[model samples]
Target: MLALSAVHETLGKILEPPTLHTAVIFTPAGQLVSWQSNPLCAKDDVHLVIGLSGDAWQGAREKGYGMVHHNHLGKILVVPVEDVERKPGEDKPPLMLLALNATDEMEWADMQVKGKALGAALTKSWSKHREHLTVPKPPQSSVAILTGSKRVTTR
Candidate 1:
């Protein structure tokens, strides 16, 4: 939980100007461990589980564009305000939702050069704090197979 908080704080500071409206960290079981920001919509609508189950996350991952940081594995769904209509009596102003799929590999290279370094730094710090978080280990056979070649695997 502390790790998530750290990430939220760090990212919030880094991503200036067009600030992030919300940031959540969920467990593998779909429990919302920690979060930062105003959740204007219903819980189920912004649930991490739903995001993961959808094709958007899978498509991003398959294209090597997963999480903002390379350490965690998850999807980032950027929902612009213009795309959604405001509800009646909802006084809160609409802001873009920056969902970070923490379970996915951090894809810093995909980000702008100015933001890449900060993202990398955050990923490094977050990894240290969340040392208990388990990352999927690469298959040993794959490492051996690629030992002498520059060819990449497509799967």
Candidate 2:
């Protein structure tokens, strides 16, 4: 399994400083697999919820974006990180690593385009390490029907 720390380090090396805040990987079932971000959000489960939301994941896939770490279904979501300030007179929360300034909207758009290339690179990398990950396959029923079956079992 890919470790969260490794994901973070890899992203940090690839993305520019302004866009290198955090990266998260989630299972198709919406479970958080690995994530690296500001300590505040890292420990906050709410961020995980946002990362694993079905809408976000599906949207990325529909847009043809995501890390193809293996042949399995997965997505890479890039969104504006919310800036949080602690209560009055308190210290500021740790800034997210990939958070970009509002004025960098154009840069963010560029990054999204670049993200597509990154996805392709990931696909190639994963293909080279295919033995390490399970590649999901389409259901057999969807591909062919068993017509010569002697018995049918329904549970």
Candidate 3:
């Protein structure tokens, strides 16, 4: 599993000055996996941003924008943490990065460089701890097959 401190340190190195109010790693379904916040940040604000940002990212993809590697939405920055080994046309990744700025001071150029670094770190973490991080689904029920009036259950 990725350490919370490591995530905090990486987020800290992304932007300076006004500083980031909060940063979070979440699932495609909008479940928060991990987060870090500055002393001045409110937990409610962080949760709200994560929920909204997850929706924004999903909307972008559904609207034919394709996978948005990074988005600069005023005071918010959303970046997808993609698997480097993913093949074309595969399902969308399960994790994303969302950062809330103290103000609308984040520059696109700066964010590109820093966001990639943060995303790469997250990707590495994902690859290393994929089994542990993934949510386990219940086994599927057997399907019934009818052949020549005989019914058989098959997995």
Candidate 4:
């Protein structure tokens, strides 16, 4: 499991003014894994990150940029915590989404640098504590499979 204090310290070292209104790590499915935020930050803000992350991820993959979007609330930057260069036969690492509620003061250059730094830190953390992080179980869904004239249900 990721320590809240570690997250705060990492963000503090990277962002301008070294403050975090909201910092969260979530799964691809928008499951909140760990977070730290200021008093002004609402838990509901996580929903916003979830929304931003999904879109930004797609946009970034398409455009090949680091900082995806910036709005009135803050900026959204996501980096893959996984090491994509794994050895053959090794399972691919899970990506940890890093979303920050950073204000405009953090310019594009600064934000890109911070995003890389944060990604490095998180990648290390992910490797060290891979088993500790929560792995959301896949939702059980009944799938219908046809066998000749019969229908079978499988989860």
TM-score of each: 0.38, 0.45, 0.67, 0.64
lDDT of 1 at 71: 27
Residues 1-155, candidate 3, lDDT per residue (tens digit)? Answer: 57777776776655455544556677665677666665556667667767666766667743321122224323555677767676767774545555444455555456555555777777876765655666655368867668998998888
Clashing pairs in 2: 20-97, 20-98, 21-97, 21-98
Using lDDT as the measure, name the better of candidate 2 and candidate 4: 4
User: Runs in model 4 with CA error above 4 Å?
Assistant: 1-20, 62-66, 87-93, 128-155
lDDT at position 61, candidate 3: 49
lDDT tens string, model 1, 27-139?
A: 32344544454333356644743355233434453332233332233334422111133355553321212344322333334333323344345444444433354434567
lDDT of 4 at 146: 87
How big is the positional error of residue 49 in model 3, measured in Å on the Cα after superposition?
1.0
lDDT of 3 at 99: 46
Q: Could you say which candidate leads in lDDT? A: 4
Instruction: Mark the regions of model 3 whose C-alpha exceeds 4 Å error after superposition.
Output: 62-74, 100-102, 136-155
Weakest 10 consecutive residues, lDDT, candidate 4?
Answer: 61-70
Each model's lDDT? 0.39, 0.39, 0.60, 0.62
Report how far off residue 50 is in candidate 4 (Å).
2.5
Give lDDT for model 2.
Answer: 0.39
